[model samples]
Structures are given as structure tokens and as C-alpha cells.
Target: MSLPFILFFVFALISVGGAILLIMAREPIHSALALILVMMSLAGLYLMLGAEFIAAVQIIVYAGAIMVLFVFVIMLLNAGTEERTDWSKIAKYAGLPLGILLLLELAHWMAHSLIGRTPANGAGSANVMVSTRELSMQLFQKYLFPFEATSILILIAILGALVLAKRDE
Candidate 1:
């Protein structure tokens, strides 16, 4: 296989593996770290596709800022590994096959969707970067309400975590 093909496969594996690890990890911190890996792998994939601006945004916004928020919340909550619980035989037997089938279906769908949609004009070089002024104007004017609502939601999340972390009866 060609080198680029190999790199794509490797990054794809890292993305999938990190997602699976995030789900399977018992500790909140481990899950958060796994999520960071997933985000970084996605950013790498964006870089490989030559959308450097998008890659940088993913690294800065999702991987850096959002992940820091997640990690901070996890640490502030002092969350620990979940206690082990017994798995039902039906869940283990049926859920595994269903999950695998869903995974296969998703893979098939993605492959088919992407196969005919290669970047036009070049190796993703045709992606247009929006101007900083346009972005700021949209963020502050058009999307201001949504942005403020999101901030409120995050604040609520932090407050809820604080309340839940209290030891008071």
C-alpha cells in the first residue's frame, strides 16, 4: 500500500480505538484522556485531508478548550472508577452481536458515502477559509444568543457537578 494510505488507516484506527477505549474505560479521567486522543486523531485526519484551518480549529477548540473543560469537571467532581457490576448473559450475548452489526453498517455507509466524494480541485486545497472578521461578526451578532445559552449550559453543568459532589446528606 502507499504511504498516505497507510497513514490514513493508522489514523483511522487511532480514532476508532480511542472511541472504543473511551467507552470501555472505567475511570472518568481515562475516558476524558481517551476522548482527547480521539479528538487529536480526528484533527490529524483533517490535517491529512489538507484542511489545515479545520485541523487547527479542532485542535484548539475541541481538543484543547472543550477537553480541558471536561477534564476540569471530572477532577472537580472527584469522580472515580465505577464499581464493577455483573453483566447479564443476555446482554453480553445479544448486545455484542448487535453492536458489531451496527458497527459494520456504519462502516459500510461511511465507505460508500466517501468513496465518490473526493475533494474537488485538489487534495482538499479548495477549502475556503472564512475571514476572521466574518467569523467574529457571526459569532457576536448572529449566533450571540446560542453562544450565551451554551455558556449558561456549561455553567449549569459546573454548578450541578458541584452540588452532586457535596457530601451533605
Candidate 2:
């Protein structure tokens, strides 16, 4: 296999392994650490795809900011101890159907994505065309409102987190 494909497979394995560890870990802090590993692996995958700007953004936004927030919240909650996760009797029936549905949805989406992708043009540049001029043009023209809206949403979420984390009166 080619180098890029090999790297992609390795990163995918790391990403999925991290996800599994995050889910199976009993300790919340360990889970958080595993999630950070998952995020870093995803950033590596983004780099392999030749989206250098997006890869950097993924590292900055998810690995740096979001993982810090996750670790902070895990510490704030003092969740080091393993919590009992045994489902109650009522949950058994509900959880079975939910799990089946989730699996079906995942399978369907995977099949759809494999079948419906548009082929990329041959002889095109492998790297993303992310010059400052192109970024500015797309940011202003195509994604202006959504970008502004997400900024507003992030501001509100930060404020909400602060309020929630404040000392109780």
C-alpha cells in the first residue's frame, strides 16, 4: 500500500482504539485522556488529507481548547472514582432497541457515504487551496452568517459554563 493510505489506516486505528478506551475506561480522567488521544489522531488524519489549515484548526480547537475544557470539567466534578454502570431493569428493554437502532444507523451511513461520493478531478493539487485570499473570500461570501452565528453560540456557551461553575449562593 501507499504511504498515505498506510498512515491513514494507522491513524484510524489509533482514533478508534482511543474511542474504545475512552468508553471502556472506568475512571473519568482516564476517559478524558483517551478522548484527547482520539482528537489528536483525528487531527493527524486531517493533516494526511492535505487540509493543513483544517488540521491546525482541529488541533487548536479540539485538542487544545475542547480537551482542556473536558479535563477541567472532569476535575471540577471530581470524577476520578469508578462509577457503577449497571443498567437498571427498566433500562434493559430501552437500551437494547437503542443499541440496535444506533448500529443500523451507523451501517447505513457508512454504506451511503461509500456509494455517494463524487470523484475528485485528476491532475488537481493534492493540498487544499487555503491561501489567505481564498479563505477571506469564502468566509465573507459563503459562510459569513454561519461563522458569526457559531461565534455567538460559543460566547453564550462560555457564559453559561461560567454561570454554572460559580459558587452556590
Candidate 3:
């Protein structure tokens, strides 16, 4: 196989392995770290696929911002490995079946819909797509409500965190 092909496969494997670790790790901090790794691997995959903007966004928004927030929440809540052990047996029983069902549904969707779909030609090219411009336009215009709603959600999350952290006066 070509070098690029090999690298692609390796990144894909790393991404999937990171996802598994994220799901299976007992410690919440470890899971968050694994999830960060998964996001980084996915960003690498996006780079390989020529989605440069998407790769950068994935790294910045998901790997940097989102996972850092998750790690902060875990530390702030003082969640520890002890809580993990308490839920281990029941979680395994519930998680395994749920994971199996999810895998089956994903496979079914892939087989029926994704296998036959051809990727849009020139879709990843910066000059051809101008995706950032188009996305900004949509965000400010047609999809403004959804964008505002997401902002509101973030505001609510901030408020909720403050409320949770406040000590009795």
C-alpha cells in the first residue's frame, strides 16, 4: 500500500481505539483524556481527507475547548475512581447491550445509506467550497435561530455551573 494510505488507516485505527478507550475507561478523567485523543485523531483524519478547515475546527473547538471544559467539570465535581468502581458492574451490564445495539444500528445505516453515496467532488477544496463564508452566512442569516439557541445553551451551562459551585452564604 502507499504511504498515505497506510497513514490514513493508522489514524483511523487510532481514532477508533481512542473512542473505545473513551467509552470503556473507568476513571472520568481518563475517559475525558481519551475523548480528547479521539478528537485529535479525528482531526488528523480530517486533514488526511483534505478538510483542512474542519480539521482545525475539530482541534480547536472539540479537542481544545470542549475536552478542557469536560476535564474542568470532572475536577470541579471531584469525581474520582471510587465512584467508577461503585457503578462498574451495573454499567457494564447496561453499557454492553447498549453498545451492541448502537453498533448494529450504525452498521445497518452504513450498509443501506453510506456505502453507495459518492463524496461530492471538489467539496473539500478551499477555493472551490468557501465553506467558512457560506457557514458564516447561514449562521447569521437562515440558521440564526439555531445559532442563537446554542449560544443560549452555553449561557445556561455557565449559569448552572455557577449555581452548582456557589457555597451557602
> Relative to the unseen true structure, what is the C-alpha lDDT of residue 103 in candidate 3, on a scale of 0 to 100?
97
Top-lDDT structure, candidate number: 1
Any runs in candidate 2 off by more than 4 Å, and if so which?
87-118, 121-133
Candidate 3 has what TM-score? 0.69
In order, candidate lDDTs are 0.84, 0.81, 0.80
Between candidates 1 and 3, the TM-score winner:
3
- The parts of candidate 3 lying over 4 Å away from their true place are 1-4, 23-27, 48-51, 73-80, 83-98, 116-130
TM-score of each: 0.61, 0.75, 0.69
Q: What are the per-model C-alpha RMSD values against the true structure? A: 4.6, 3.7, 3.9
Error of 2 at 23 (Å): 0.5
Cα deviation of 111, candidate 3, in Å:
2.8
lDDT tens readout by residue for model 1, 14-54:
99999999988999899999999999999888877766767
Ranking by TM-score: 2, 3, 1
Where does candidate 1 clash, by residue pair?
Answer: none
The TM-score between candidate 1 and the true structure equals: 0.61
Better by TM-score, candidate 2 or 1: 2
Residue pairs in steric clash, candidate 3? none
